[model samples]
Every structure is written in C-alpha cells, then in structure tokens.
Target: MTSAPVTQPLPPQVFPPTLREVMLRPRWIALLAFSLVVAGVLAWLGQWQLGRAVDTSPPEPGLTEVVQPLDQVVQPGDYLPEPLVGQRVEVSGTWVASDFIVVSSRFNDDVEGYWVTGQLRVAGAAAPTSIAVAAGWTSSLDAANAAADELERQVSADPTAVVQVTGRLISDEGPSVPPSGADPLTITRMSPPMLLGRWHDTAELNVYRQYIASQTAIGPLDDISSPAPDERSRVNWLNIFYAAEWAIFAGFALYLWYRLARDAWEKEVEDLEDEQAEALAESSTSSSATGAAESRG
Candidate 1:
C-alpha cells in the first residue's frame, strides 16, 4: 500500500493591531492627557490678551486735560511712593545750565544726536529741590554744544527766572553703557548715575522728586519733551494670539488622533474576521481529509 505524502504545517501569521485598537489601549492615555493640557494653556493665553485689550482706560482724562503746577501736583515724596507714574504736572524752576548732559536719542526716523538734559531748581519750595528736564535733541555735536550753550545763556540771563516746564512724572533712567570717548562734554547717553555724579560737579543742590518737559516751542527747536503723546503702555497680546493658535492646533491634533484610531480599529476588525474565516476553512479541510482517509480504509 502506498503511503500518503506528509504535508508541512504552515507558519502562523501575526497581524498588527489597527490604529483604532492602539488608541483604545492604556499606553496612549498619557498622550491624550498632554494634548488636553496644551489646549487649556492656549485658551488661558487668549483670555489674558483679551483682558489686556480691555483693561487699559484712556490716560487719566483728568490729569492730561488740566495742567497743574509741578510743585502743587507732585510732592517731595511723590516719586518714592510710586504715585507719580502717570501724574501730569507743570514746574517752575531755574534750569541748571552747567549740569546739561547730552543723551543719545532718536527722532523722526533719523538718529538725532543726543538729548540736552538739565536740572531745574524749584523756586518756592520750603527746602529747594531740583527737577530733571529733557530739553531736546540736536543733529550734530556742534548743534548739541550750541543748544547747551544757548540754554545756559538763558538760565544765567535770569538766575531766578520762572521757566515753566510740563510733563508726566517718570522714574529715573537706570545706568546705561557709558560712551567710549575722550571728551567730557560729548556723552553718548544720559543715565541716572551719570547725572547724579555730575550734580556734585555742577552744584550742591539736591535732585527734586520729579522731571519736566517744555510744552511750547522754545526757539528753532523741533521737539523739546520727554514722554510724547503716542508713547506705548504695557500689555502685549502676541502671546495671547499664539495661545489661540496653539489651542486650534491641539484640537486638530485630537481630531487627527481620533481619525487614526478609527482607521486602526476598522483594520483590526477586518483582520480578525479574515483570521476567523481562515481558521474555519482550515477546520473544514481537516475534517474532509479525515473522512476521505476513513472511507479509503
């Protein structure tokens, strides 16, 4: 009797789980949580920007509209206690000509040479105090020097001259990089420390609690003031915009994850069905082979 040929068993095939099945797994839980956190952060930033956009009221309408004497509006301790950030005041004092310092400044798209900063000695205060004043900027070194000279002539012409100065009270400018030069008169920038140091050389006067700027045109001058009308206040909303954009991206990310998961699940289900059909066919084939062998026997 001829022996039946032996058949080799087929290798078991392993199918990968579909995208949907993978998302259903516990491993992807952290990913989902992180996405939610990112979305929340983005939403928070947008709200913060919106708050900034609305929070700013028009510059204290009362202060800007009415021009009060600097001495009356600002006290000796006004700057120290932080009540002078936005207070507009007018000051009457004699400009200390010798104490003029040239500070680097820009105007009208061109780099105007430097600002002529001077100290003003307030007249009627019980104890005399000095106020800082930013006179103006000039194009050339000669012009800067001439401006300082002309200001000195004006101050010396009237020692007790009641020069009227008006401006918003601001904090002292901090120390800046000193200009590299040999000339003492030609400075690149003005800083609080530099001005204070020069005060000893100029006079024995104590610096007052505030600074001033001339509102009217003093001569052939262009602009003679610190803190212009269009100066920007704090509150940048770029971060908020970015946050909104990030939130939108997060939502899209979630959507993408869902789509991938669904596709994976469908693929997994199809694979499982194919496997079941393959198993059933194998079983039927085995049964048929057994019946044939028995019949032959």
Candidate 2:
C-alpha cells in the first residue's frame, strides 16, 4: 500500500516594514537622536547669528574707532561698507591649523614683505564660517614660513583653543595669478578665496569677503600695521544678512532630518518591491513545475 504524502505548510506572508516601522528600529532611532542633537546645535547657532543680523540702530559716527563685535560689523558674504573698511572689530575664533598660509608682497608702513595668514573659524556659529586673518608680517620668506609653521603647531596642540583677535576689518585684495615661472602655490594677495583653496577641511566653508589685519602677530611674528581707511561706507546691513543666514541654517537643520528619513524610506521600499517580485517569480516557477509533473503522470 502506498503511504499518503504529507503536505508542508505554507510560510507566513512576508510584508515590508513601513516607514514608521523602520524609523522605530533601534538603529534608526539612535540615528534620529544624533540628527536631533546636530539640528539642535545648529538651531542654537542660527539663533545666535540672528541676534547680530541687522543692527536696527545705525552705527553712529566714529563707529570705526569703537571695537565692534565681528558679527555686528559685518556678516560673512556681505561687503564691508566701504567706510567700515578700517573698522576695528573683535573676533572670537579658533585657528584652523592647516590653513596657515604665507602670502607674498604685503606692505606694512610701505615696507613690502610676506604675511602669514590663517583661517579663523568663527566661534559660536553653527555654520562653517571663517575669516581670513593676516596673523603677522615678516620681511623674510623664511620668517613667514616659520611663523606659519609655529602657528600650525600651536593650533594642532590645542585645536579648540579660542583666541580673540582685535583687528582692522580690511577689504580683500582680489586674488591674482602667479607671475610667469613663479611657484604655482604662491599667493600674492590677502584674498579669502585664495587662502581657502590652500586650506584643509574647507568643505562647505563660508568665508568673509573681507579679511582681518591682526593688531598683533601670533607666535614669533611681527604685528601687521593696519592704518585706518580714509573713508567709511554708510549703511548697516550686517545684521540683516546675518539674520537671513540663521533662518536658512535653521530650515536646513530640519530638512536634514526629513531628508534622512525619506531616503531610508525610499531604500526600504525598493528592497521590499524586489523581495515581493522574487517571491512571485518563485511561486510561478513552482506552480509550473507542479503542473508539468501532474501532466506527465
């Protein structure tokens, strides 16, 4: 007598995890927490930026002489009012070590020399903003390089050290290409974009069009003599520009979270669709095989 064959039970239906379900996963949850922290920090920084964007009351005459906060005097990406070109501003930031570069043909009191410059990553700004700082001046190229090296060493040793630099907010000397047969890396002007090109960790860097001539040099360097500008421009748009940055930053922070979630959801949906297709294909093949076997019987 032939024994009856036992049929195997069908496997339970497989369903893809919903977006909400995927987000609730421990891995995604942890990621969400991290994003939230980042967003919160950005929000706070944007708020800080807002407080300085557009000073409602125009700076009275002689504002140039009064040491104003860097953010109060000019926002990153805004032109320094021509009159505020010689404004004495106090900037708080940490030096970006690898960004210390030597710029040639700087004149101090009409004496031509080299200037050691560095990128000053602004303090308390969530945005990756920086200001070019002419750290010191030297008549000798060796001295300029040495000063730049020393500053880099000091920054690497204590990367987070925040230093306050009081300086004249001078307009950028537009960048110039190296002269014929000159070293390709040679930078002749105090241009932020020029210096930024040589700077490390410059991804998404926001820099001031104007640079700072430090009142005193750092680490074995001579001070940069910055005489006041002959004229100043009228208008106070610094605060207004800064406020706009804050709004953009805040919106970006929230968008980042949504983007991450949406990307994950999209990836999950694709995976689910692929899995469902595979299952259908396998089921169809099995049915075809079973029908063929019965027909042959």
Candidate 3:
C-alpha cells in the first residue's frame, strides 16, 4: 500500500483584535498617561487645601479698645463687615428676662448643656433684639432651671447695673427640632424649630438674621476671645484625601488596561510565529515530494 501523503499540522487560528487592544497596546504610554492624570488631580487638591490653610485672617486685635455700640455699628439688614467678625463690641442694654429661650446643645469649657437665650433691649431702641449668652451647662433639667433662675435674679436685682457686655458677635444658628421626648433644657444641642415652638410669636424677632453674642460674664468678665475669621477658613484636608484616593483608583484602572493589552499582544505574536513556522514546513515537504516524483518519471 502507498504511504499516506505527508502533511504538516495546521497552526491554531488567532481571534480578531478589539478596540481596547489597539488603544492600550503600549504599557509605557498607558502608565505615563495614568500617572500624569493622577498627579494633576492630587496636585490640584493639595493646592486647594493649601489655599484654604492660608486664606484665613488672624484675629483682629484691640477689640476692647475699639468697642462701639452694637446697634450703631450694625443694623438688622446690614452685614457685619469682615473686620468686625470677631471684634469685641459693647452694648448698653437691660436684660429682657421674660423672653428667655433654652437652646439645646450648649457647652461650657467642661460640661455639655443648654444655652439660655434672651432678648436684650438696647437702652434707647424701641425694639429688643435676641442674644445668646452661653450659661453654664447642667446634665439635668433641674440644674438648667436653677441656672436660669440665678440669671433672672441677677438681672432683676441689678436692672440698672448698666451692664457693658463684651463678647464675639456670632450669627444666630437657626433653630432645629430634636426627636420626640427630647428636653430642650437638658439636651446638649437642638435645632431652630424647637426654640421657635417655645416662642409666643416667632415672627416678632428676625430669627433668621439674629446672632449669638457670647456673654463673657454678667459684667465685662475676662475670657478668651472668639476665633478669627481666617482661622475658620482652613480648607478641610479630608477633601484632598478623598481626591487622592480617586487618583489612586484611576491609576489602578490604567494599570489593568495596560497589563491586559500587553498580554494579548504577546499572545498574538506567539500565534503568528507558530503559523509562519508551520506554513514553511508544509512548503518544504511539498517541494521534496515533487523532486522525488520527477526522478521516478
């Protein structure tokens, strides 16, 4: 019987290329792009944080020396200029004790408690404005009441004391409501709605525009002054941290793309080499068979 005709085995076929394969075939290019984008974003966030850190102004000096009447210096519709943000100002007023409201979540140096807010009637102004002087906090309602009573007694006993109150002028924190069963007097802090509920006529006062004028003491008592506006402007670094994390993820995505593309390219090259080798082997065998047939003829 004639020997079966010799034939070379066929090489495995290659799959069609994809868009992703062409785009990220080069690992270095992908890596470079990824690093640049990540660095740019991180640098931007870092600069923003640095700007925030430097944007703040130092606390104004000579607050006591530049004391002026609160009503004269500011009006209901007027904005307190940046220069006066934390300045100590003097107002001659009689305490309107009956209008006191308990603000929740007030704290002293050591204890968490409530703020006893009251209206201060300027010596000559027809309308009284609200002011919040942080009274000492107590853990219980009874203690808060005791503190309120003490403040009331002090105001009543010394109505004509011509109290020159000095404190940092802070914008009113609008009211809020606490969960049911939460006591405003004993709770550490509460929202604006809860305080408004206790008011006979919430509309009487411009609650939205009112501010907390910290009372250092019943008299011009000494304490640390309020913080400067610039100090409050420091950019939150956590935002930068979040940006950095995003950049890292972007870099990782780029890395994954590059790795997959490189692996696919190497596989394609190997397949092509194998096919070429098989084609050459088949051609060589065909030529040798033709030569032997010609000699027989």
Clashes of each: 7, 7, 12
- Candidate 3: TM-score? 0.50
Stretches off by above 4 angstroms in model 1 are 11-15, 54-56, 60-65, 68-88, 93-97, 102-115, 121-130, 136-164, 167-185, 188-194, 201-211, 216-228, 231-240, 245-297
Choose the strongest candidate by lDDT: 2
- lDDT at residue 251 of model 1 (Cα atoms): 77
Candidate 2 ranges beyond 4 A from true positions: 1-61, 231-297
RMSD of 2: 17.4
Better of 1 and 3 by lDDT: 1
lDDT tens digits by residue: candidate 2, 59-140: 5777688898999888989998755778999989999888889999889889999999989999988799999988899999
Ranking of all predicted structures according to TM-score, beginning with the best and ending with the worst: 2, 1, 3
- Number of backbone clashes in candidate 2: 7
- The stretch of ten residues in a row with the least summed lDDT in candidate 2 is 2-11
What TM-score does model 1 achieve against the real structure? Answer: 0.55
For each candidate in turn, the TM-score is 0.55, 0.57, 0.50
Tell me the spans in candidate 3 whose CA falls farther than 4 Å from its real position: 1-97, 102-115, 121-129, 135-164, 169-187, 190-193, 208-216, 219-236, 246-250, 256-260, 263-297
Ten-residue segment with the worst summed lDDT in candidate 3? 217-226
Backbone steric clashes in candidate 3, count? 12
Task: Assess candidate 3 and give its lDDT.
Answer: 0.55
